[model samples]
Target: MGSAVNDFAGEFDKQRFQTVDDACKLVLKHFYMAKVDLKAAYRSVRISKKLPFRSKLAPGIFHKLSQAVRRMMSRRGFTIVAYLDDFFICERTKKRCAQALAVLIALLRKLGFCISWSKVTDPCQKIVFLGVEIDSTTLETRLPISKLTDLKSELAEFLLRKHASKKQLQSLAGKLNWASAVVRGGRVFLRRIINGIMRLKQDWHKLRMPGEILQDIKWWHDFMSTFNGKSFFLAKVPITSVVTDACKSGAGGFYHSDWFYVNWVEDYPFATQLHINELEVFSVALAVKRWAQNWRGKRIIVYCDKAATVSCMIQ
Candidate 1:
Protein backbone atom coordinates (compact mmCIF):
# COMPACT_ATOMS: atom_id res chain seq x y z
CA MET A 1 0.00 0.00 0.00
CA GLY A 2 1.11 3.59 -0.63
CA SER A 3 1.73 6.05 2.21
CA ALA A 4 -1.54 7.97 1.79
CA VAL A 5 -3.57 4.79 1.75
CA ASN A 6 -1.53 3.42 4.63
CA ASP A 7 -2.58 6.46 6.64
CA PHE A 8 -6.26 5.44 6.45
CA ALA A 9 -5.49 1.81 7.14
CA GLY A 10 -3.30 2.87 10.03
CA GLU A 11 -6.21 4.79 11.52
CA PHE A 12 -8.42 1.73 11.23
CA ASP A 13 -5.76 -0.35 12.93
CA LYS A 14 -5.53 2.03 15.88
CA GLN A 15 -9.31 2.18 16.21
CA ARG A 16 -9.60 -1.60 15.92
CA PHE A 17 -6.71 -2.55 18.19
CA GLN A 18 -4.97 -1.06 21.18
CA THR A 19 -1.39 -1.04 19.91
CA VAL A 20 0.67 -2.05 16.92
CA ASP A 21 4.18 -3.49 17.10
CA ASP A 22 4.79 -5.96 14.32
CA ALA A 23 2.78 -8.29 12.09
CA CYS A 24 3.84 -11.24 14.23
CA LYS A 25 2.62 -9.50 17.39
CA LEU A 26 -0.70 -8.80 15.72
CA VAL A 27 -1.28 -12.48 14.89
CA LEU A 28 -0.85 -13.35 18.54
CA LYS A 29 -3.39 -10.81 19.83
CA HIS A 30 -6.37 -11.24 17.54
CA PHE A 31 -8.26 -14.50 17.78
CA TYR A 32 -9.26 -14.29 14.14
CA MET A 33 -8.40 -11.71 11.52
CA ALA A 34 -8.50 -11.18 7.80
CA LYS A 35 -6.60 -8.89 5.50
CA VAL A 36 -8.49 -8.19 2.32
CA ASP A 37 -6.85 -6.28 -0.45
CA LEU A 38 -7.71 -5.44 -4.03
CA LYS A 39 -5.48 -7.36 -6.38
CA ALA A 40 -3.15 -5.34 -8.63
CA ALA A 41 -4.37 -2.42 -6.60
CA TYR A 42 -2.22 0.19 -8.31
CA ARG A 43 -2.44 -1.37 -11.73
CA SER A 44 -6.15 -2.04 -11.53
CA VAL A 45 -7.09 1.58 -10.93
CA ARG A 46 -7.61 3.43 -14.20
CA ILE A 47 -5.46 6.54 -14.36
CA SER A 48 -6.94 9.96 -14.93
CA LYS A 49 -4.81 12.47 -16.79
CA LYS A 50 -6.00 15.02 -14.32
CA LEU A 51 -3.91 13.37 -11.58
CA PRO A 52 -0.49 14.92 -11.74
CA PHE A 53 2.56 12.73 -12.01
CA ARG A 54 3.70 11.58 -8.60
CA SER A 55 6.14 8.70 -8.79
CA LYS A 56 8.09 7.59 -11.82
CA LEU A 57 5.22 5.64 -13.40
CA ALA A 58 2.56 6.80 -10.95
CA PRO A 59 0.61 8.84 -13.50
CA GLY A 60 -0.04 5.99 -15.93
CA ILE A 61 -0.39 3.60 -13.05
CA PHE A 62 -2.85 5.85 -11.26
CA HIS A 63 -4.75 6.32 -14.51
CA LYS A 64 -5.32 2.60 -14.68
CA LEU A 65 -5.85 2.65 -10.93
CA SER A 66 -8.88 4.94 -11.28
CA GLN A 67 -10.39 2.57 -13.80
CA ALA A 68 -9.83 -0.29 -11.41
CA VAL A 69 -11.53 1.61 -8.59
CA ARG A 70 -14.49 2.32 -10.89
CA ARG A 71 -14.71 -1.33 -11.82
CA MET A 72 -14.51 -2.26 -8.13
CA MET A 73 -17.44 0.00 -7.27
CA SER A 74 -19.75 -1.07 -10.11
CA ARG A 75 -18.82 -4.73 -10.58
CA ARG A 76 -18.20 -5.86 -7.02
CA GLY A 77 -21.17 -4.06 -5.50
CA PHE A 78 -18.56 -2.69 -3.06
CA THR A 79 -16.81 0.64 -3.09
CA ILE A 80 -13.34 1.12 -1.70
CA VAL A 81 -14.51 3.20 1.25
CA ALA A 82 -10.99 3.02 2.68
CA TYR A 83 -9.81 4.75 -0.54
CA LEU A 84 -7.91 1.53 -1.12
CA ASP A 85 -8.62 -2.22 -1.17
CA ASP A 86 -8.54 -2.80 2.61
CA PHE A 87 -11.95 -3.94 3.89
CA PHE A 88 -12.60 -4.68 7.54
CA ILE A 89 -14.98 -7.44 8.61
CA CYS A 90 -15.82 -7.84 12.29
CA GLU A 91 -16.45 -11.43 13.33
CA ARG A 92 -16.31 -13.52 16.51
CA THR A 93 -14.77 -16.67 15.01
CA LYS A 94 -11.77 -17.66 12.94
CA LYS A 95 -13.94 -19.51 10.47
CA ARG A 96 -15.83 -16.30 9.81
CA CYS A 97 -12.64 -14.28 9.43
CA ALA A 98 -11.16 -16.86 7.08
CA GLN A 99 -14.36 -16.84 5.13
CA ALA A 100 -14.12 -13.09 4.91
CA LEU A 101 -10.50 -13.21 3.77
CA ALA A 102 -11.19 -15.92 1.23
CA VAL A 103 -14.24 -14.15 -0.09
CA LEU A 104 -12.54 -10.78 -0.27
CA ILE A 105 -9.41 -12.16 -1.90
CA ALA A 106 -11.34 -14.26 -4.37
CA LEU A 107 -13.75 -11.50 -5.19
CA LEU A 108 -10.96 -9.08 -6.01
CA ARG A 109 -9.17 -11.78 -7.94
CA LYS A 110 -12.23 -12.45 -10.00
CA LEU A 111 -12.44 -8.78 -10.80
CA GLY A 112 -8.77 -8.90 -11.89
CA PHE A 113 -7.60 -7.11 -8.76
CA CYS A 114 -4.24 -8.09 -7.30
CA ILE A 115 -3.30 -8.00 -3.64
CA SER A 116 0.01 -8.08 -1.81
CA TRP A 117 0.05 -11.36 0.05
CA SER A 118 3.15 -10.27 1.91
CA LYS A 119 1.20 -7.48 3.55
CA VAL A 120 -1.95 -9.46 4.31
CA THR A 121 -2.52 -10.54 7.91
CA ASP A 122 -4.37 -13.76 8.67
CA PRO A 123 -6.38 -14.18 11.90
CA CYS A 124 -4.24 -12.58 14.57
CA GLN A 125 -4.70 -10.79 17.86
CA LYS A 126 -1.63 -8.59 17.43
CA ILE A 127 -1.10 -6.85 14.12
CA VAL A 128 0.63 -3.74 12.88
CA PHE A 129 -0.46 -1.57 10.00
CA LEU A 130 1.20 1.61 8.86
CA GLY A 131 3.45 1.38 11.95
CA VAL A 132 0.47 1.40 14.31
CA GLU A 133 0.01 -1.51 16.71
CA ILE A 134 -3.35 -3.13 17.20
CA ASP A 135 -4.67 -5.10 20.16
CA SER A 136 -7.97 -6.73 19.31
CA THR A 137 -9.32 -6.50 22.85
CA THR A 138 -8.57 -2.88 23.66
CA LEU A 139 -8.47 -1.73 20.03
CA GLU A 140 -6.44 1.38 20.78
CA THR A 141 -3.13 1.46 18.90
CA ARG A 142 -0.75 3.46 21.08
CA LEU A 143 2.90 4.21 20.60
CA PRO A 144 5.36 1.41 21.25
CA ILE A 145 8.44 1.29 23.49
CA SER A 146 10.77 1.52 20.54
CA LYS A 147 9.47 4.97 19.64
CA LEU A 148 10.77 6.23 22.95
CA THR A 149 14.20 4.74 22.26
CA ASP A 150 14.37 6.52 18.91
CA LEU A 151 13.30 9.82 20.39
CA LYS A 152 16.10 9.51 22.89
CA SER A 153 18.68 9.04 20.17
CA GLU A 154 17.44 11.99 18.08
CA LEU A 155 17.21 14.28 21.06
CA ALA A 156 20.41 13.02 22.65
CA GLU A 157 22.31 16.28 22.44
CA PHE A 158 19.22 18.37 22.95
CA LEU A 159 18.35 16.42 26.08
CA LEU A 160 21.91 16.46 27.39
CA ARG A 161 21.52 20.14 28.41
CA LYS A 162 25.29 20.54 28.54
CA HIS A 163 25.00 22.63 25.35
CA ALA A 164 28.49 24.12 25.67
CA SER A 165 30.20 24.05 22.26
CA LYS A 166 27.02 23.15 20.33
CA LYS A 167 25.03 26.16 21.46
CA GLN A 168 24.36 27.66 18.03
CA LEU A 169 22.34 25.72 15.42
CA GLN A 170 24.98 26.69 12.86
CA SER A 171 27.74 24.66 14.57
CA LEU A 172 25.36 21.71 14.71
CA ALA A 173 23.81 22.65 11.39
CA GLY A 174 26.00 20.03 9.75
CA LYS A 175 24.37 17.37 11.88
CA LEU A 176 20.96 18.92 11.32
CA ASN A 177 21.46 18.92 7.58
CA TRP A 178 23.07 15.50 7.37
CA ALA A 179 19.88 13.48 7.32
CA SER A 180 18.00 15.70 4.91
CA ALA A 181 20.88 16.44 2.60
CA VAL A 182 21.42 12.88 1.43
CA VAL A 183 18.03 11.31 1.98
CA ARG A 184 15.84 14.07 0.54
CA GLY A 185 18.22 14.75 -2.29
CA GLY A 186 17.16 14.51 -5.95
CA ARG A 187 17.15 10.83 -7.02
CA VAL A 188 18.60 9.06 -4.01
CA PHE A 189 15.23 9.71 -2.35
CA LEU A 190 16.08 9.48 1.36
CA ARG A 191 12.52 8.75 2.43
CA ARG A 192 11.23 5.94 4.60
CA ILE A 193 9.71 3.06 2.67
CA ILE A 194 7.59 0.37 4.36
CA ASN A 195 8.45 -2.63 2.21
CA GLY A 196 11.56 -4.26 3.69
CA ILE A 197 12.50 -2.42 6.86
CA MET A 198 11.91 -4.43 10.01
CA ARG A 199 11.79 -1.75 12.71
CA LEU A 200 11.47 1.98 13.33
CA LYS A 201 13.96 4.31 15.03
CA GLN A 202 11.94 4.21 18.27
CA ASP A 203 10.35 7.56 17.45
CA TRP A 204 6.74 7.80 16.28
CA HIS A 205 7.70 11.03 14.60
CA LYS A 206 10.02 9.03 12.31
CA LEU A 207 7.36 6.58 11.28
CA ARG A 208 7.25 5.73 7.56
CA MET A 209 4.60 4.23 5.32
CA PRO A 210 4.57 2.11 2.21
CA GLY A 211 5.57 4.91 -0.15
CA GLU A 212 8.89 5.64 1.53
CA ILE A 213 9.58 1.97 2.01
CA LEU A 214 8.78 1.19 -1.62
CA GLN A 215 11.05 3.97 -2.84
CA ASP A 216 13.88 2.72 -0.64
CA ILE A 217 13.57 -0.81 -2.00
CA LYS A 218 13.59 0.51 -5.55
CA TRP A 219 16.76 2.49 -4.92
CA TRP A 220 18.46 -0.56 -3.44
CA HIS A 221 17.31 -2.74 -6.32
CA ASP A 222 18.59 -0.22 -8.83
CA PHE A 223 21.78 0.07 -6.84
CA MET A 224 22.47 -3.63 -7.14
CA SER A 225 21.79 -3.36 -10.85
CA THR A 226 24.40 -0.62 -11.14
CA PHE A 227 27.26 -2.53 -9.56
CA ASN A 228 28.60 -6.01 -8.83
CA GLY A 229 31.24 -5.60 -6.13
CA LYS A 230 31.19 -3.17 -3.18
CA SER A 231 30.32 0.12 -4.82
CA PHE A 232 32.05 3.28 -3.59
CA PHE A 233 30.94 6.81 -4.43
CA LEU A 234 34.05 8.67 -3.27
CA ALA A 235 37.45 7.24 -4.10
CA LYS A 236 39.73 10.07 -5.10
CA VAL A 237 39.07 12.07 -1.95
CA PRO A 238 41.21 11.43 1.13
CA ILE A 239 39.62 9.36 3.89
CA THR A 240 38.25 11.18 6.97
CA SER A 241 35.64 10.37 9.59
CA VAL A 242 32.48 12.29 10.48
CA VAL A 243 29.22 11.66 12.34
CA THR A 244 25.99 11.54 10.32
CA ASP A 245 22.34 11.93 11.34
CA ALA A 246 19.16 11.95 9.27
CA CYS A 247 15.42 12.28 9.57
CA LYS A 248 12.39 13.23 7.49
CA SER A 249 11.39 16.82 6.75
CA GLY A 250 7.83 17.95 6.18
CA ALA A 251 5.68 21.04 6.69
CA GLY A 252 5.71 20.31 10.40
CA GLY A 253 9.54 20.62 10.62
CA PHE A 254 9.66 18.76 13.89
CA TYR A 255 13.09 17.26 13.17
CA HIS A 256 15.68 17.17 10.42
CA SER A 257 14.73 14.05 8.48
CA ASP A 258 15.40 12.56 5.07
CA TRP A 259 14.42 9.27 3.50
CA PHE A 260 17.40 6.96 3.90
CA TYR A 261 18.31 3.40 4.78
CA VAL A 262 19.26 2.10 8.18
CA ASN A 263 22.52 0.96 6.66
CA TRP A 264 22.84 3.88 4.31
CA VAL A 265 26.61 4.11 4.28
CA GLU A 266 27.44 0.62 3.05
CA ASP A 267 24.17 0.05 1.22
CA TYR A 268 23.92 3.30 -0.70
CA PRO A 269 25.19 2.92 -4.29
CA PHE A 270 28.37 4.60 -5.42
CA ALA A 271 26.49 6.14 -8.33
CA THR A 272 23.96 7.91 -6.12
CA GLN A 273 24.16 11.49 -4.96
CA LEU A 274 27.42 12.38 -3.18
CA HIS A 275 26.38 14.77 -0.44
CA ILE A 276 29.02 17.16 0.83
CA ASN A 277 29.11 15.59 4.27
CA GLU A 278 29.41 12.11 2.82
CA LEU A 279 32.24 13.27 0.63
CA GLU A 280 33.94 14.91 3.61
CA VAL A 281 33.63 11.76 5.69
CA PHE A 282 34.88 9.65 2.80
CA SER A 283 37.87 11.94 2.39
CA VAL A 284 38.67 11.68 6.07
CA ALA A 285 38.26 7.88 6.22
CA LEU A 286 40.57 7.48 3.26
CA ALA A 287 43.10 10.08 4.40
CA VAL A 288 43.41 8.42 7.80
CA LYS A 289 44.00 5.06 6.19
CA ARG A 290 46.69 6.52 3.94
CA TRP A 291 48.33 8.27 6.85
CA ALA A 292 48.17 5.24 9.16
CA GLN A 293 49.77 2.93 6.61
CA ASN A 294 53.08 2.97 8.52
CA TRP A 295 51.47 2.82 11.99
CA ARG A 296 49.97 -0.22 13.73
CA GLY A 297 47.26 1.57 15.75
CA LYS A 298 44.91 4.20 14.36
CA ARG A 299 41.85 5.78 15.94
CA ILE A 300 38.99 7.28 13.97
CA ILE A 301 35.96 9.31 14.99
CA VAL A 302 33.19 9.49 12.43
CA TYR A 303 29.87 11.29 12.72
CA CYS A 304 27.17 11.68 10.11
CA ASP A 305 23.52 12.48 9.53
CA LYS A 306 23.02 9.30 7.58
CA ALA A 307 21.93 6.71 10.12
CA ALA A 308 23.45 3.93 8.05
CA THR A 309 26.87 5.52 7.98
CA VAL A 310 26.79 6.26 11.68
CA SER A 311 25.56 2.75 12.34
CA CYS A 312 28.82 1.44 10.95
CA MET A 313 30.69 2.60 14.05
CA ILE A 314 28.20 0.92 16.34
CA GLN A 315 28.16 -2.29 14.32
Candidate 2:
Protein backbone atom coordinates (compact mmCIF):
# COMPACT_ATOMS: atom_id res chain seq x y z
CA MET A 1 0.00 0.00 0.00
CA GLY A 2 1.13 3.55 -0.77
CA SER A 3 1.65 6.02 2.02
CA ALA A 4 -0.81 8.91 2.47
CA VAL A 5 1.82 11.35 1.21
CA ASN A 6 2.20 9.44 -2.04
CA ASP A 7 -1.55 9.33 -2.60
CA PHE A 8 -2.50 12.90 -1.73
CA ALA A 9 0.34 15.38 -1.70
CA GLY A 10 3.51 16.31 -3.56
CA GLU A 11 4.80 14.67 -6.75
CA PHE A 12 8.16 13.73 -5.19
CA ASP A 13 6.91 10.22 -4.52
CA LYS A 14 5.27 9.63 -7.88
CA GLN A 15 6.60 6.96 -10.23
CA ARG A 16 7.86 8.36 -13.52
CA PHE A 17 8.33 6.79 -16.93
CA GLN A 18 11.80 5.34 -17.49
CA THR A 19 14.13 7.41 -19.62
CA VAL A 20 14.75 6.27 -23.22
CA ASP A 21 18.49 5.93 -22.57
CA ASP A 22 18.02 3.41 -19.77
CA ALA A 23 15.29 1.47 -21.63
CA CYS A 24 17.54 1.16 -24.67
CA LYS A 25 20.25 -0.33 -22.48
CA LEU A 26 17.87 -3.09 -21.43
CA VAL A 27 16.84 -3.84 -25.01
CA LEU A 28 20.48 -4.25 -26.02
CA LYS A 29 21.08 -6.77 -23.24
CA HIS A 30 17.84 -8.75 -23.70
CA PHE A 31 17.21 -9.93 -27.25
CA TYR A 32 13.65 -11.15 -26.67
CA MET A 33 10.92 -8.66 -25.65
CA ALA A 34 7.15 -8.52 -25.02
CA LYS A 35 4.68 -5.74 -24.18
CA VAL A 36 1.55 -5.97 -22.02
CA ASP A 37 -1.32 -3.54 -21.69
CA LEU A 38 -3.87 -3.22 -18.92
CA LYS A 39 -7.09 -1.96 -20.52
CA ALA A 40 -8.38 1.27 -18.97
CA ALA A 41 -5.89 0.89 -16.11
CA TYR A 42 -7.03 3.83 -14.03
CA ARG A 43 -10.70 3.33 -14.87
CA SER A 44 -10.54 -0.34 -14.02
CA VAL A 45 -9.17 0.23 -10.51
CA ARG A 46 -11.68 -1.16 -7.98
CA ILE A 47 -12.13 1.62 -5.48
CA SER A 48 -14.52 1.67 -2.57
CA LYS A 49 -18.13 2.02 -3.71
CA LYS A 50 -18.64 4.85 -1.25
CA LEU A 51 -16.01 7.03 -2.85
CA PRO A 52 -17.63 9.54 -5.19
CA PHE A 53 -16.45 9.95 -8.77
CA ARG A 54 -14.96 13.39 -8.10
CA SER A 55 -13.70 12.65 -4.61
CA LYS A 56 -10.34 13.97 -3.48
CA LEU A 57 -9.40 10.44 -2.44
CA ALA A 58 -9.29 9.27 -6.03
CA PRO A 59 -5.53 9.74 -6.52
CA GLY A 60 -4.72 7.99 -3.24
CA ILE A 61 -6.96 5.12 -4.27
CA PHE A 62 -5.24 4.86 -7.60
CA HIS A 63 -1.79 4.99 -6.06
CA LYS A 64 -2.67 2.15 -3.74
CA LEU A 65 -3.93 0.15 -6.69
CA SER A 66 -0.75 0.71 -8.71
CA GLN A 67 1.43 -0.16 -5.73
CA ALA A 68 -0.50 -3.36 -5.23
CA VAL A 69 -0.09 -4.39 -8.85
CA ARG A 70 3.62 -3.60 -8.85
CA ARG A 71 4.16 -5.65 -5.68
CA MET A 72 2.25 -8.63 -7.03
CA MET A 73 4.16 -8.66 -10.30
CA SER A 74 7.55 -8.31 -8.61
CA ARG A 75 6.95 -11.23 -6.25
CA ARG A 76 6.09 -13.47 -9.20
CA GLY A 77 9.71 -13.26 -10.56
CA PHE A 78 8.58 -11.48 -13.75
CA THR A 79 10.86 -8.45 -13.71
CA ILE A 80 9.37 -5.67 -15.84
CA VAL A 81 9.41 -1.94 -16.38
CA ALA A 82 6.20 0.04 -16.52
CA TYR A 83 4.67 3.42 -17.31
CA LEU A 84 1.12 3.65 -16.05
CA ASP A 85 -0.80 0.92 -17.90
CA ASP A 86 2.02 -0.24 -20.22
CA PHE A 87 4.48 -2.95 -19.12
CA PHE A 88 7.66 -3.89 -20.99
CA ILE A 89 9.17 -7.33 -20.46
CA CYS A 90 12.65 -8.10 -21.71
CA GLU A 91 14.24 -11.56 -21.54
CA ARG A 92 17.26 -13.43 -22.89
CA THR A 93 15.19 -16.22 -24.45
CA LYS A 94 11.77 -16.90 -25.99
CA LYS A 95 10.93 -19.39 -23.25
CA ARG A 96 11.54 -16.81 -20.52
CA CYS A 97 9.35 -14.30 -22.39
CA ALA A 98 6.52 -16.81 -22.71
CA GLN A 99 6.75 -17.71 -19.04
CA ALA A 100 6.70 -14.05 -17.99
CA LEU A 101 3.71 -13.29 -20.23
CA ALA A 102 1.70 -16.18 -18.87
CA VAL A 103 2.45 -15.18 -15.29
CA LEU A 104 1.67 -11.50 -15.95
CA ILE A 105 -1.63 -12.17 -17.72
CA ALA A 106 -2.79 -14.64 -15.09
CA LEU A 107 -1.94 -12.19 -12.31
CA LEU A 108 -3.69 -9.29 -14.05
CA ARG A 109 -6.87 -11.33 -14.54
CA LYS A 110 -6.77 -12.59 -10.94
CA LEU A 111 -6.50 -8.97 -9.77
CA GLY A 112 -9.64 -8.18 -11.83
CA PHE A 113 -7.99 -5.75 -14.27
CA CYS A 114 -9.13 -6.23 -17.88
CA ILE A 115 -6.27 -6.81 -20.36
CA SER A 116 -6.28 -5.24 -23.82
CA TRP A 117 -5.66 -8.25 -26.02
CA SER A 118 -5.46 -6.12 -29.14
CA LYS A 119 -2.62 -4.03 -27.72
CA VAL A 120 -0.73 -6.99 -26.22
CA THR A 121 1.81 -7.69 -28.91
CA ASP A 122 3.91 -10.87 -29.05
CA PRO A 123 7.65 -11.07 -28.46
CA CYS A 124 9.63 -9.53 -31.29
CA GLN A 125 13.15 -8.51 -32.24
CA LYS A 126 11.97 -4.89 -32.55
CA ILE A 127 9.26 -3.14 -30.56
CA VAL A 128 7.94 0.32 -29.88
CA PHE A 129 7.10 1.72 -26.46
CA LEU A 130 6.37 5.31 -25.47
CA GLY A 131 6.72 6.45 -29.08
CA VAL A 132 10.32 5.09 -29.26
CA GLU A 133 11.12 2.14 -31.53
CA ILE A 134 13.77 -0.14 -30.02
CA ASP A 135 15.76 -2.55 -32.22
CA SER A 136 17.31 -5.16 -29.95
CA THR A 137 19.53 -6.71 -32.59
CA THR A 138 21.20 -3.46 -33.65
CA LEU A 139 20.94 -1.87 -30.18
CA GLU A 140 19.37 1.35 -31.48
CA THR A 141 16.32 3.50 -30.76
CA ARG A 142 14.43 5.90 -33.04
CA LEU A 143 11.20 7.79 -33.08
CA PRO A 144 8.44 5.85 -34.85
CA ILE A 145 7.30 7.05 -38.28
CA SER A 146 3.78 7.66 -36.97
CA LYS A 147 4.97 10.19 -34.38
CA LEU A 148 7.19 11.93 -36.91
CA THR A 149 4.32 12.23 -39.37
CA ASP A 150 2.05 13.73 -36.71
CA LEU A 151 4.68 16.28 -35.68
CA LYS A 152 5.31 17.28 -39.31
CA SER A 153 1.57 17.58 -39.92
CA GLU A 154 1.10 19.82 -36.87
CA LEU A 155 3.95 22.14 -37.93
CA ALA A 156 2.63 22.32 -41.51
CA GLU A 157 -0.84 23.27 -40.34
CA PHE A 158 0.61 25.87 -37.98
CA LEU A 159 2.68 27.55 -40.72
CA LEU A 160 -0.24 27.66 -43.15
CA ARG A 161 -2.01 30.39 -41.19
CA LYS A 162 -1.38 34.02 -42.28
CA HIS A 163 -1.48 35.24 -38.65
CA ALA A 164 -0.86 33.33 -35.41
CA SER A 165 -1.68 34.19 -31.82
CA LYS A 166 0.85 33.91 -29.02
CA LYS A 167 -0.95 30.78 -27.79
CA GLN A 168 -0.59 29.12 -31.16
CA LEU A 169 3.08 30.11 -31.35
CA GLN A 170 3.74 28.62 -27.95
CA SER A 171 1.90 25.43 -28.91
CA LEU A 172 4.03 25.07 -32.01
CA ALA A 173 7.20 25.68 -30.04
CA GLY A 174 6.15 23.13 -27.43
CA LYS A 175 5.69 20.49 -30.11
CA LEU A 176 9.19 21.12 -31.44
CA ASN A 177 10.67 20.98 -27.95
CA TRP A 178 8.90 17.70 -27.24
CA ALA A 179 10.61 16.20 -30.26
CA SER A 180 13.97 17.47 -28.97
CA ALA A 181 13.91 14.68 -26.38
CA VAL A 182 14.73 12.27 -29.21
CA VAL A 183 16.31 14.68 -31.71
CA ARG A 184 19.78 15.96 -30.87
CA GLY A 185 20.30 19.74 -30.99
CA GLY A 186 16.62 20.04 -31.88
CA ARG A 187 15.68 23.06 -29.74
CA VAL A 188 18.01 25.35 -31.70
CA PHE A 189 15.55 25.21 -34.61
CA LEU A 190 12.92 26.95 -32.45
CA ARG A 191 15.12 29.83 -31.27
CA ARG A 192 13.71 32.21 -33.86
CA ILE A 193 10.10 31.33 -33.18
CA ILE A 194 10.56 31.52 -29.42
CA ASN A 195 12.37 34.86 -29.56
CA GLY A 196 9.69 36.24 -31.83
CA ILE A 197 6.95 35.34 -29.38
CA MET A 198 8.93 36.73 -26.43
CA ARG A 199 9.28 40.08 -28.22
CA LEU A 200 5.52 40.46 -28.46
CA LYS A 201 3.98 42.94 -26.01
CA GLN A 202 0.58 42.62 -24.37
CA ASP A 203 -1.00 42.00 -27.73
CA TRP A 204 -1.05 38.22 -28.10
CA HIS A 205 -3.48 38.00 -31.02
CA LYS A 206 -2.68 38.79 -34.65
CA LEU A 207 1.03 38.65 -33.97
CA ARG A 208 3.33 40.10 -36.63
CA MET A 209 6.44 38.43 -38.04
CA PRO A 210 9.57 40.39 -38.86
CA GLY A 211 11.92 39.70 -41.80
CA GLU A 212 14.14 37.42 -39.67
CA ILE A 213 11.13 35.48 -38.50
CA LEU A 214 10.04 34.97 -42.09
CA GLN A 215 13.53 33.76 -42.96
CA ASP A 216 13.39 31.28 -40.08
CA ILE A 217 10.06 29.95 -41.31
CA LYS A 218 11.68 29.17 -44.66
CA TRP A 219 14.74 27.66 -42.97
CA TRP A 220 12.49 25.40 -40.91
CA HIS A 221 10.76 24.11 -44.04
CA ASP A 222 14.09 23.31 -45.68
CA PHE A 223 15.32 21.66 -42.50
CA MET A 224 12.27 19.40 -42.30
CA SER A 225 12.59 18.48 -45.96
CA THR A 226 16.07 17.12 -45.33
CA PHE A 227 15.05 15.12 -42.26
CA ASN A 228 15.16 11.34 -42.92
CA GLY A 229 13.87 10.04 -39.58
CA LYS A 230 17.14 10.40 -37.70
CA SER A 231 18.14 7.37 -35.62
CA PHE A 232 20.28 7.23 -32.41
CA PHE A 233 22.43 4.33 -31.21
CA LEU A 234 22.58 3.09 -27.64
CA ALA A 235 25.95 3.49 -25.93
CA LYS A 236 27.22 4.00 -22.38
CA VAL A 237 29.43 7.09 -22.43
CA PRO A 238 31.35 9.05 -19.80
CA ILE A 239 29.89 12.52 -19.05
CA THR A 240 31.89 15.74 -18.70
CA SER A 241 30.24 18.68 -16.96
CA VAL A 242 30.46 22.16 -18.51
CA VAL A 243 29.46 25.22 -16.50
CA THR A 244 28.41 28.31 -18.46
CA ASP A 245 27.45 31.91 -17.70
CA ALA A 246 26.35 34.92 -19.71
CA CYS A 247 25.48 38.61 -19.63
CA LYS A 248 23.57 40.82 -22.07
CA SER A 249 26.64 41.37 -24.25
CA GLY A 250 28.62 38.14 -23.93
CA ALA A 251 28.79 34.52 -22.72
CA GLY A 252 31.48 32.12 -21.50
CA GLY A 253 32.05 28.58 -20.23
CA PHE A 254 34.36 26.75 -17.82
CA TYR A 255 35.26 23.16 -18.65
CA HIS A 256 38.22 21.11 -17.31
CA SER A 257 39.98 24.25 -15.97
CA ASP A 258 39.83 25.85 -19.42
CA TRP A 259 37.75 29.04 -19.92
CA PHE A 260 36.31 30.41 -23.15
CA TYR A 261 34.37 33.57 -24.07
CA VAL A 262 32.32 34.85 -26.96
CA ASN A 263 31.70 38.59 -27.44
CA TRP A 264 28.25 39.37 -28.79
CA VAL A 265 28.81 40.62 -32.35
CA GLU A 266 26.38 43.43 -33.05
CA ASP A 267 26.46 42.68 -36.80
CA TYR A 268 24.94 39.24 -36.19
CA PRO A 269 21.15 39.21 -36.33
CA PHE A 270 20.83 36.74 -33.39
CA ALA A 271 23.15 38.68 -31.09
CA THR A 272 21.22 41.95 -31.30
CA GLN A 273 17.90 40.40 -30.16
CA LEU A 274 19.19 37.54 -27.99
CA HIS A 275 17.67 37.56 -24.52
CA ILE A 276 19.71 36.65 -21.44
CA ASN A 277 18.13 33.19 -21.38
CA GLU A 278 18.98 32.73 -25.05
CA LEU A 279 22.53 33.90 -24.35
CA GLU A 280 22.92 31.26 -21.66
CA VAL A 281 21.61 28.57 -24.01
CA PHE A 282 23.83 29.87 -26.82
CA SER A 283 26.85 29.61 -24.54
CA VAL A 284 26.14 25.91 -23.97
CA ALA A 285 25.45 25.28 -27.63
CA LEU A 286 28.67 27.04 -28.54
CA ALA A 287 30.57 24.87 -26.09
CA VAL A 288 29.06 21.70 -27.51
CA LYS A 289 29.84 22.62 -31.12
CA ARG A 290 33.41 23.56 -30.19
CA TRP A 291 34.13 20.27 -28.41
CA ALA A 292 31.79 17.85 -30.23
CA GLN A 293 34.58 16.16 -32.22
CA ASN A 294 36.50 15.22 -29.07
CA TRP A 295 33.34 14.32 -27.16
CA ARG A 296 31.76 12.32 -29.93
CA GLY A 297 29.44 9.62 -28.46
CA LYS A 298 30.05 11.06 -24.96
CA ARG A 299 27.44 12.83 -22.82
CA ILE A 300 28.08 16.49 -21.99
CA ILE A 301 26.50 17.75 -18.78
CA VAL A 302 26.00 21.51 -18.99
CA TYR A 303 25.38 23.52 -15.83
CA CYS A 304 23.98 27.03 -16.36
CA ASP A 305 22.72 29.52 -13.79
CA LYS A 306 19.63 30.26 -15.87
CA ALA A 307 16.87 27.73 -15.08
CA ALA A 308 14.94 28.64 -18.21
CA THR A 309 17.99 28.01 -20.38
CA VAL A 310 18.64 24.61 -18.81
CA SER A 311 14.99 23.62 -19.28
CA CYS A 312 15.05 24.78 -22.89
CA MET A 313 18.20 22.77 -23.69
CA ILE A 314 16.74 19.60 -22.17
CA GLN A 315 13.44 19.96 -24.03
Global lDDT of each candidate:
0.40, 0.70
Among all candidates shown, the one with the greatest TM-score:
2
**Model 1 spans with C-alpha error above 4 angstroms:** 1-31, 37-40, 55-85, 138-140, 155-315
TM-score per prediction, in order, is: 0.32, 0.63
Which runs in model 2 stand beyond 4 Å of their true positions?
1-22, 40-43, 47-64, 75-78, 162-181, 185-223, 241-280, 303-315
The 10 consecutive residues of candidate 2 with the worst lDDT sum are 2-11
User: Could you tell me the lDDT of residue 28 within candidate 2?
Assistant: 53
lDDT for predicted candidate 2 compared with the true structure: 0.70
The ten-residue window of minimal lDDT in model 1 covers 249-258
On residues 116-186, what C-alpha lDDT tens digit does candidate 1 reach at each position? 78777786655444444445654444334464244234444333332223123222233322322112231
* Best lDDT among the predictions, by candidate number: 2
lDDT of 1 at 124: 62
